[model samples]
Target: MHDQDRKLLQQMFEAAVHAAEPGAAMRPFLPARPAGRVVVVGAGKGAAQMAAALEELWAGPLEGVVVTRYGFGVATRGIRVLEAAHPVPDAAGVAASEALFAAVEGLGPDDLVIALITGGGSALLAAPVAGLGLADEVALNEVLLSSGAPIGAMNALRRILSRVKGGRLAQAAHPARVVSLIVSDVPGDDPAQVASGPTVPGAGGRAAALAAVEQFGIALPERLGSALEQGEEPPRPDDPGFARDEVHVIASGAKSLEAAGAVARAAGFTPVILSDAIEGEAREVAKVHAAIAREVVLRDRPFARPVAILSGGETTVTLRRTGGRGGRNSAFLLSLALEIEGLDGIAAMAADTDGVDGSEDNAGAFADGTSAARIRAAGVDPAAALARDDAWSAFAAVGDLYVTGPTGTNVNDFRVILIR
Candidate 1:
């Protein structure tokens, strides 16, 4: 029975992700064959696929390089799609990023530059600011990840310190007509924050970025701290680099949720889409969801039994203790499990649609009312695990963590709560 539930939950989440795939969302926004040079530079899990889609549609000499996660490369006749590391930058990614900047060099104002941006692109674009080595950026990333900062906070810091992020890339291709087609992963689809806003002109300065890091209690390397405080930050909107740019959010959480809701309905369960932009700490978000579910079970308010509550958005996890091995979704699931202890006939799933959550290979976690009790009987304390931000251990203790190698596309996260 649990297997069937798990399968259903996975199907729902998969459908949600597919709905926001770049191919599905990018077709309409593609410009006509440019009269001059047409260069496509993109980064994300979906870049290769998006490139193929664009190549198929345009008959001109479409040439460029796009970096995707390892094993995600697809054959495209014209565009060179390079595979790179995601969530973490590697030497290969750094080299490819350097090559990408070189690829679009020397283009004129008559040229058309198509930039495909999506989730995970921030790390994929590994060109750190001058004087800031790869190790420095990695150290900063580590601090922000453990700080429990929201996606916006993490990205704010990234935009300030990186050379190629936060509109710097677009600025590099200055004089060229730059059009960015983005598959949004951040809440509100703020073009400036998506994938560290490589193409969109960014907000805030070096001081603002440093302030965000400090506000979130994130530590920075000594050198990085001094650089951010002394050196000029990344190109902001005030810079002359903001000359000509157009950014269009091709896919978003709402579209993904609607697609998942359709799948749920097709699977014989009533679907209730809560919101696509839900934001907060993972555990607190889970508690509120549990409260609503309890009402549905007892009072049938807002939604009746046999309905699935769907939501999409990025959630944060403030890590207080170390040794936790889970993403926000699993943390949310474990927290929900503890809150709904002893409650009967309810199920939930929370996962990053990208198929990796909080640096874990697993997509997310799933649990019903008995999830907490089952772990306790197995000599695991879900509360202790959660308090340590070690949700993966707690769920793994009972074989509840959901692992999907790579979905090849990303739109942040998808969560489903079913009451039956």
Candidate 2:
């Protein structure tokens, strides 16, 4: 039963990821080819795949550059693919950002700019504003990741600090028709929040950015803080530069969750999509999911047996200490495992749709009622691992780590719990 449940979970994850593939999602959203040159600029885990799909679809001449995480790149003909670091800015990303700007520069109004934006662009397409360097952006990402602030708040702060983000890229391509096709990983599916709104205009400006800093107790660098206090705000929605721009969210977590649900139903389990926008700390969110699964298994209150409770969202992990080895999905499954230990007829999987969770190689992990016992038998203390934010180690000890190489897409977290 455990083996079957794990297989079903893997199938659901694959289905969810397949639904958000750039080849399929970008097809319906592709803009008409312009009489003038079409410039493609993009950044994210899926940017290379998006560019490749565009090359396959568009017959006209298109040339541009896109930046994706180092291992996520795919071969493309017209659009050049650049590799860069993710979740942190590197020198390569700075160069890629310059390349993106150059790609769209000197374009006439007749020319069209198709901006393929997705999650992870904030880090992969790094261009720090004046008075800040790549190192500063790297430090900022580290702080934000460990601060327990939600992705929206972190992006709000990121938008203010970046030169290529917050519609600045669109501003750079003034007079050209900019059509942004987005794969949203943020909770609300706001294009601005995804990749910090490189094409779409930013909202709330410095005030919102500052508020997030204060709320998260983030200690910004003295220079960065000063820049936030005095720097010119990003272009607003009313900015004439964006009048010709079009934004379309081609794929999102909600769509991925629905795809996963269909797979669960086909497998003979009634799938209950709890929510696609769930947020909070990873462990806390796991507690809630565990509670619901327990209720369904014990008394069948909310859902009866043979049910799959599915959810999709970006859950955060607040790094209490350094040296942890897993991402939020693994951490979440570990917490769920502890909560449901010894509870029969329940198993779950949590993974990032991009096939890499946090900085780890594994997409996520699997857990069952016997997970805790199995982990203990492997001579590891699950509670201690959880306390250290080392959930990856716990799962690895028992061979439960779900490692799927880059899936060429990013729709954030995909989690499913099975009760039978």
Candidate 3:
């Protein structure tokens, strides 16, 4: 029965991820083929797959360059796909973003720019503004990630310090009609926040970015601070460059969670979707989930036995120790393992939809009644692992680390807890 429950939970996760696949969700949102050339450009975990899907659907000549995370690249006939680092900027990403800028430059009104935007675009489109090196951008990103800043705040800083983000790419296309098809991973599915709104106008300016940085007590480089002071912001919503630009949300976390819920129903389980926009410190969020799971087990007031509690959203993790080896999802699972304390007939899994969590290779990890027992029998200390942020090793020792190589989509994190 435990093995069967694990299989069911894994199936639910796979269903959630498949619902956000670029090839499936991108087709209906495709723009009409323009009379002139079609130029495609984008950045994210799924950009290459999205480009491939567009090429498969369109019957016209399309030429463009798209940047994706290193392992997420897909082969396309016409559009060139480039691999780059994600969650942090790299030289390869910077070069690819510049190439994309050149690809859409000096386009006329007849030409159309199809931008495939997704969760990781902020890092994939790493064209830094003048006076900021890739190292500087990378350092800032490291601080932001470790500081536990929300995606919106981090993306705001990304836009201010970038040459291609915050509607600057749309501004570069000038007279061309820019159509941005987005896969949202952030809460609220704000078009302006997805991928730092490379083609969509941002809602705020340098002031907001500065406040976010200061709120987190992050020290900005001298040049970055100066740039923020200078207040050369991204294109406003009323900017003429976005006059003809259009943005469409092809898929989102909510849609993915709903798909997961459907899978649970088919498997003869009552699935309760808690929320699709959950966000907070990962361990704190795990405790909240633990509390709810306890309620279902102890009182069964909100939900009864044979139920699955599902949620989807991006959660932040503030690192207290250096040289830790886990992402937010793993951290959440680790904390959850400690919280539940080996409760019987309950199992849970937390994973990123993109098949990569933080800097690790595995998507995430899972915990069940026997998870702690397995770790203890192997002579590993789970509490110490959680304290040092070494969840990868802890879960790996128990063979509970969930790994799915490059799912070609990014809808942020998906979590489900099963009670029986």
Ranking by lDDT: 2, 3, 1
Q: Indicate the TM-score of model 1.
A: 0.93
Error of 3 at 187 (Å): 1.2
Q: What TM-score, over all chains together, does every model reach?
A: 0.93, 0.98, 0.97
Which regions of candidate 1 deviate over 4 angstroms? Answer: 1-4, 238-243, 267-270
In terms of lDDT, which candidate is strongest?
2
Query: Residue-wise lDDT of candidate 3 within 1-420, one digit each (tens)?
Result: 278888988899899988998888988888888888899988888888889888888888999999998878888998999988887788998899888999998899999999998888888888778877888778777788888888888877877888888899989987999999999988889988888888988877888898998887767777777866774678889986677888999999999999999998898889899988888999899999988888888898578888999988888888889888989899999888888885887889999998998889999988976776688777789889888888888999888999998888888889999998
User: Model 2, range 68-117, lDDT digits (tens) per residue?
Assistant: 99989998987899999987789999999999999989999999999998
Candidate 1's displacement at residue 87, Å, is 2.1
> Candidate 2 — which residues are off by over 4 angstroms?
none
Candidates' C-alpha lDDT? 0.83, 0.90, 0.87
Instruction: Find the 10 residues in a row with the least total lDDT in model 1.
Output: 236-245
| Superposed model 3: Cα runs more than 4 Å off | none
Clashes of each: 0, 0, 0
